[model samples]
Target: MRRNVIGSVEQMTGLQVVEVNIDVTDLQLPEDDEQHPLHDGTRRVR
Candidate 1:
């Protein structure tokens, strides 16, 4: 469902989506928790 939405936005705006990131910072631990932030939460197109 998410992929289709992003693809539609890209097609409509003619702007390519450089990346798709999904993160869960709230669920991270202090012990060597190396995870990227959430970009999936963002649905805005360029």
Candidate 2:
């Protein structure tokens, strides 16, 4: 449902969608504490 809407918008705007990050995971976190605070909460689509 949401994906269809996104496709429609992209078609109308003719802009390239780099990525649509939706979910976050602990495994994506960095082992370093310094990097942890800088984490953007990004995750793979599938």
Candidate 3:
């Protein structure tokens, strides 16, 4: 499901995704209503 979603975004945006970076360096926990900035959107980008 995730792969298809990304692929669709890439195609629509005409951007070649070089790599999907996994951010594990800054691991500060979230507070109330402060959900993930990247995930809480129609286009999930990193």
State TM-scores per candidate: 0.35, 0.32, 0.33
Candidate 1, residues 1-46, lDDT tens digits: the string is: 4587689889999998877665433443455344535544444443
Higher-lDDT candidate of 2 and 3: 2
Number of clashes recorded per candidate: 0, 0, 0
1-46: candidate 3 lDDT, tens digit per residue: 4577679879999997766654454443447225765545354235
- Measured on C-alpha atoms, candidate 3 has an lDDT of 0.60
> Among all windows of ten consecutive residues in candidate 2, which has the lowest summed lDDT?
21-30
Residue range 1-46, candidate 2, lDDT tens digits:
4587678778999987665655444454246644766556654355
Q: What is the lDDT of residue 4 in candidate 3?
A: 70
Candidate 3 stretches with Cα past 4 Å from truth are 17-46
What's the TM for model 1?
0.35
Question: Which pairs clash (backbone N, Cα, C closer than 3 Å) in model 2?
Answer: none
Candidate no. 3 TM-score? 0.33
Alpha carbon lDDT of residue 5, candidate 1? 68
lDDT against the true structure, per candidate, is: 0.61, 0.61, 0.60
